[model samples]
Target: MSSAHALMLQGAARSARLLEETQAQWRASGDDLLLFAYGSLIWRPDFEVEQALPARVQGYHRVLRMRSRVNRGSPEAPGLVLALVSGGSCRGLVYRVARHDAEAVLTALWAREMPTGVYDPKWLVCDTPHGPVRALGFTLSRRSANWCGALSDSELLHIFQHARGRYGTTLDYLLRTVDGLRAHGIRDRELERQARLAAAHGLCTPTI
Candidate 1:
């Protein structure tokens, strides 16, 4: 066997293990499960949602600081994605899944968000319009290799202009997210600013 083929097999095996572990962990969490959507999940849950409401989670902020090497770009040229990082607060949507469907919903979520195991999924307290509740969310780990930290406006625009993957372009992801937030009367200045930068470069259409 060739060295390149062996490495490919190793990578596939690693991804399979990650998926299995994520499914097991989520299953053990409990029957009642809530998921917080702070990014693409807001617009595209792609899962069965029994109930969804506007919610705010403290001690975290939504920022485009993670690399999406598959959804929005390839391994050679990764695109950026949002993840909840420590500090501040974030307003988004909290979705409650039916107890019977918890396993399936979480399994799909893990498969979509944990392809690289870069996010740490946890249940956090969220203040919703109805009331406060505990919800599951994916947060970024500073220790993860995919963490992009902060980037300049120029860097952001460049990535938005060129990055594309199986899902779509990175710019499409950003614009759609801001649009989703707007529908909920949520204004994310940071994301809006990045969209404007991309629009100024003719990479993305202005949605704000």
Candidate 2:
């Protein structure tokens, strides 16, 4: 096989193994499975959820600082996606999955989010209106190859204009995320600022 194709297969195998390990760990813990959603998961959770509550996770905040090579952008002209980086706090939704359905739900989640094992999945304490719940959250390390760190306005504008993947454009993803957060009465000023930047440049119509 070609070298690039072989690397892709290797990444896929690693992702599968990681998913299996995570599932085994969760099963052994004997606790309810909770998923923390901060981005597209907030709008599109393709699994059956027992309950979804507005949750805030401390010590990590959301930022559109990851490169999407398959879902939201191409490899050549990569687009940005959200990830939970260290420091600050994040406001999003936490989904509770019934014990009976956790396995199936997690399998589907792995396929969607861990296609190449780009994220580090961790069990985090999410504070909800009711109480604190331990939830599975995806975080990205700054050292990861997919980490975008920080981008200037020109870089973002270029991605907004050119990047497109199997799912859709990066601009659409950002707009949708901002809309989802707004619907939950969660105000993320930084995300809103990016949306405004896009609108100001006439890249997309304002939705927030």
Candidate 3:
């Protein structure tokens, strides 16, 4: 093949190799775990989960803890990150897997939730009926104009209560959360109260 054709062929080969490696990683991880969804993932079930239930995790509060990196991912990109709002506690659901499926499960979740370094990963303790579940979480990286420290309770709820994105709006996410919780036969008072406060405070206003 010519030099130009050779280079192009090499690049394609490398891309295919990377994809194979990624799939291998997923298969190796097996199943039986999941990262909680305190934010947008609650609404968007892009990643396939064995099962999801309303459960609490500890040491992190659900803060509007992310910088909105629109250019990186959205309808335009693919992945999305609602950074961990630091400095508080977050309560959300614990998605269960098959114990040997962490690799594939996480990769899928990352594709849907965190496509790139627009947001980084963090380890948090999850409060579950079984016990504290350690899982990976997606949060805003320190690389964006929208990067802001964890927003206060009022701020978080306000954003979700009235935020919108390319795929949908903030209100849409909140509405989904309400529905998801109800489906689990649970009512998240904290989230519900935050939604109320967000409405009262007005979500359209600047939260960060």
- Descending-TM-score candidate ranking: 2, 1, 3
Query: Best candidate per TM-score, number?
Result: 2
lDDT of 1 by residue, 132-176 (tens): 988888888777777888888888877887889889888889999
Give per-model TM-scores. 0.87, 0.95, 0.56
**Tens digit per residue, CA lDDT, model 2, 38-151:** 999998998888899999999999999999988889879888888999999999999989999999999989888888788889989999999998899999899988898889
Segments in model 1 whose C-alpha atoms lie over 4 Å from true places:
1-30
**Model 1 lDDT at residue 42:** 88
Off by over 4 Å in 2: 1-3
Q: Rate residue 67 of model 1 by lDDT.
A: 88
Local error of candidate 1 at 17, Å? 6.6
Cα RMSD to the true fold for all candidates: 2.8, 1.3, 8.2
* Cα-based lDDT for every prediction: 0.83, 0.90, 0.54
Give the per-residue lDDT of model 3 (tens digit) for 159-187.
45444455565555555566665666656
Candidate 2 accuracy as lDDT: 0.90
Cα RMSD for predicted model 2: 1.3
